[model samples]
Target: MPKIPAMTTYDAHPMHDRVVLITGGAQGVGRGIAQAVLGAGGSVMIGDLDKEAGAACLQEWQVGDRAAFRQLDVSRESSVRRWVDAALARFGRIDGLVNNAGIADPLREPLHTLPLEKWNRYINTNLTGAFLCSKYTLPALNKANGAIINIASTRALQSEPDTEAYAASKGGLVALTHAMAVSVGPSVRVNAILPGWIVTDAWQKPQKRHTPKLSRIDHQQHPAGRVGTPEDIGALAVYLLSSAAGFVTGQHFVVDGGMTVKMQYA
Candidate 1:
């Protein structure tokens, strides 16, 4: 099926008056973003490839008329359109969109051994998916003078071995952020945030979820005194979409606990 829906409500929070569309929002980082919006009082139409996760999220936010879920395969143009339509039909209007959909795996295979299908999957889901979501949602966003936050990663700037596909996809998102900021400016703002080491093990669905295994080195390695959280990125997302950052656009923020700035030695 192209789309589906589950509805609820969350009110009188920081984003109390806004309605947003979040992609890949059924688990991990996406789930965090969804919770952030709901916590801030903003309503959301979250989409994801995992139907189980989507169902779970819908049940969790099953309060009133403010929230819903749709199974979305962002890589498919038809799916993207249907998801957007399901949102508009349910919520009446859209105030913002978060292009947070993408495969999270950073495969450790050598470049020579990497399969063509894997590379295509990364590009299609990570880069092309954002393009399609932005293309289809621009009209609604322009109507509301909304914002777009592309969830890039620290890998965009720097990367480890066997991470070429993931890094390239994120880098493309960073580039797309500025390009869209200029193209859709005045009516809509666009920005990208690169999050690093956010421990999302505990944020998954019931069966797959587990306690995070963090160590002293993980906390000490970051300049922020600890690893990052989904809320960190989620909070920035709220700010970027709010009136406070009305003048901000075409910017890239690295929310990596200052890890990118610290010099590393062997």
Candidate 2:
């Protein structure tokens, strides 16, 4: 056979042969993580409930057999198990997991006034989802000495108004990361990323338009000069997954641009 061109030959990052499963991969931070994994030459299984958007994301990141999508509702045990099984069937193995599926506090109500049902929904999706996915995929990931990156929020560390459930769920997730790290040691690693002020579609551009103008204080809050983008968090996620971070685990990484550090002055 003639010499194969090196450029045309298959090559990937250190993780090129690895397989990763990302929850909420249809949009925002999840979609960004999928793109990062694709660029690294890794096979990625995107699990999300948004079929239309997930299909679009898969097409956008099409790279031969390197990408796939599965419809998943993380709140349900059956759904989470199904996606994990499907990913293993297609890829034969799993190298890592990014638990990025979560819902914010639907209603901006005071904690005392928050509805029990809404609170349950937030806890189920944000906290319980990670537990279910991790519990089910432990076997496949353990084989590869894989990692788990939970997508937490700065709210887990700090707080704002009307965000009780979101903060609590994320804080619980951070704790969960440490627990898994210790319990799953010598075979697997677990960590969490706390992102601040990321301008996700759901956060920055809601479907319903707001009639009021943003205050100057809102514009001046971030010390980074502008709000964060999904890609910012995605880059960090990629780094944490790579072998470059082999010794790093059981840690919480905050990817905010000094927003949490700054002291608000009147």
Candidate 3:
């Protein structure tokens, strides 16, 4: 009989020597993921439309050559292409991509009052942006057998009033995840993370950063007993991008502190 292998402790740097590109990485969830990748001994190239926030991230991280940042408008193909080219130039290869950029505001005018321009804005930034990033990065990702993580929202599965545009955009992102997964499998992996109520007050730019305000009821409402944080999403992202999740693909993982699973009676 063959002897059983001994179990080992978890690796501290599972992403060593890897490089990941994160869109809208200057703040919020994107910033959290970038920090996690760097913490796991991986490099990062952050692309965001906010130049000040991007510079702030670079200054704060101080990871030297292991991290880079560029202003990117993911909704524009030229901007996406430039960002991708810049990343490859700096890191030489791409190991993962995180499509985390989108307008955070969910409240919009009533669907009947919503203008076509407003709806298009959400779709262009949230859905088309991911497509552009993936399209331009696919070649490099394929060569490296990398992964893609789309930062969708729990709104995709559920919605509230005045959230039509945001909900639809996220729902489209969830569908895009599976479609891309099937289209790029065997060489590249694609997945989505639906986050719920993550408090990003402290994850913003220096001028905008502040302590999050929460009430006891807020903490008690979630089955997890607390509101979520950027780190919560970041930790999962690191795992999904690592070899530990090699078998996982074309799936949407909800990291909403069990809020979505709870039944609420009006």
* TM match of model 1 to true structure: 0.93
Q: TM-score per candidate, in order? A: 0.93, 0.87, 0.97
lDDT of 1 at 265: 98
lDDT by residue (tens digit), candidate 2, 90-171: 9999999999999954356798988899889989999999999999999998899899999988889988788888888999
Please give the TM-score that candidate 3 achieves against the real structure: 0.97
lDDT of 1 by residue, 44-116 (tens): 8999999999888888777577789999999999999999999999988889899999988877778998999
Model 2 vs. true fold: TM = 0.87
Q: Quote the positional error of residue 159 for candidate 3 in Å.
A: 0.4
Best-to-worst TM-score order? 3, 1, 2
Best by TM-score: 3
Q: Report clashes for each candidate as comma-separated counts.
A: 4, 0, 0
| Clashing pairs for predicted structure model 3, backbone only | none
Worst 10 residues of 3 by lDDT: 107-116
Task: Using lDDT as the measure, name the better of candidate 1 and candidate 2.
Answer: 1
Best by lDDT: 3
lDDT of each: 0.90, 0.84, 0.95
Residues 78-171, model 3: lDDT tens digits = 9999999999999999999999999989965799999999999999999999999999999999999999999999999999888899999999
